[model samples]
Target: MAKIMALDYGLKRVGIAATDDLQIIASAIGTQPTAHIWEFLKTYLAQNQIEAVVLGDPKNLDGSATDATAPTEAFANEFRKRYPEIELHRMNEVFTSRIARQTMVSGGMKKKQRQQKGMVDQISATIILQDFLSRRSNGLF
Candidate 1:
């Protein structure tokens, strides 16, 4: 009954999300500074049972790796090195930020709240987790 976790990696900060033990729904956990992500994960993993880690794969419209891709890949590599037992998967995250913003707007989030980049990041991570869950459940991952 371990849960699955998702990460929306960014240059300055990272968004985090996790599913329940049943893995039926994804929920935003929080955001953390990029420099402290590993430390945060270490603490989090100690208290929670995570089956795997899903990372958002950033790509350009031409389907090429974006500027953020290399850093994310490096982070994933380090993550694997740090936690060799945990599986890591990447999910396409083409427009997760835009989609998250739109969702917030449509969901009646106030302008002040919407302006919080951390909130957007958390939502984007949730979206990425949900997408990964959907694909996984459909055997399309």
Candidate 2:
């Protein structure tokens, strides 16, 4: 089976993560500047056989879309337009940042590492991918 990629999009930087070829373990791919996202993704897609792309979708606590949602959805749309053959999925991104922080803490990350916002993005992408994998494993449409 082809691997999957997950993205945690920000205005300036984007966090990326990918699943193993077996689709069992998720790993942080790194963060990239918005200006280089397309090139980075093109190179990554060319190197790895990715079947789908998952993006973090921000929403309000009450399930309403947030202001960031607009740009995120736009990004997803543009990504679809650019990579028409790839499947794109948006996963609800609630508490992902918090979870990322907690994960860093639990992982005994250094202060400097924890202070880096890019690390949070990578962790967020991992969480997004994990959620997507779980949902797919359960056959949730």
Candidate 3:
């Protein structure tokens, strides 16, 4: 009944989300600065039984890797090195940010709140986790 976590990696901050032990719902955990992301994730995994990790893979509109991909990959590599016991998966995150922004707007967030980058990051992590959960539910991955 371990939970799965999703990470939306950025240079400055990383958004985190997790699913219930039943794997029925995704929830935004929080955003942490990338300065000690590995340490933070290790503590989180120790506290919560994390079975696997799903990472958002940035891509261009044409399905090519975005400029951010390099850093993201580096982060992923570091993550793997830090926690080799956990499984890892990747999901295309082409429009998660845009969709997160739209969702925030539709939810009536104020302009100032919307301006906070962590809000979008958290939503993006949620989106990534939802996508991963859906695919798992469908038995497609």
Candidate 4:
């Protein structure tokens, strides 16, 4: 099966993740600077068999658009236009950052490591990928 990629995109950094070739496991790839993400994607997409891309859709708890919503939408539009061949999907991202922080704390990560913003971003991306796989397997996608 082709791999599915996920992104926890932010203004400064974008966290990347991908499912294994077998599509059984989601793994954190890395975090890339937002400014350089296009270059990274151009190379990675060329080398990998990615079938689709999942991007986090930031929203408030009440389902209203958050401050990040506009920027995320703009990025999505640009992504679609730039890579029309690859399918792009959005998944609600409410508390992914909080969850990632908690995960790192509970996982006994060193304080310095846990405090790294990039680490949290990567974990958040993995969570997004896992959520997509779970929903798709449950026929909810």
- Highest lDDT against the true fold, candidate: 1
Return the TM-score for each candidate structure.
0.98, 0.96, 0.95, 0.98
* Per-residue lDDT of candidate 3, residues 100-123 (tens digit): 999999999999998999989999
Worst ten in a row by lDDT for model 1: 132-141
TM-score of 4: 0.98
Per-residue lDDT tens digits for candidate 2, residues 1-141, read: 999999999888899999999998888999999889999998989999988999999998899988888889899999999999889998999999999999999999998999998999999999999999999999983
- Candidate 2 Cα misplacement greater than 4 A, ranges: none
Estimate, for each residue in 1-141, the C-alpha lDDT of model 1 and write its tens digit: 999999999999999999999999999999999989989999999999999999999999888999999999999999999999999999989999999999999999999999998999999999999999999889997
lDDT of each: 0.96, 0.92, 0.92, 0.95
In TM-score terms, candidate 1 sits at 0.98
Give the Å shift of residue 95 in candidate 1.
0.3
What is the lDDT for 71 in model 4? 90
Ranking by TM-score: 1, 4, 2, 3
Runs in model 3 deviating more than 4 A are none
TM-score of 2: 0.96
What tens digits encode model 4's per-residue C-alpha lDDT throughout 38-106?
999999999999999999999999999988899999999999999999999999988899999999999
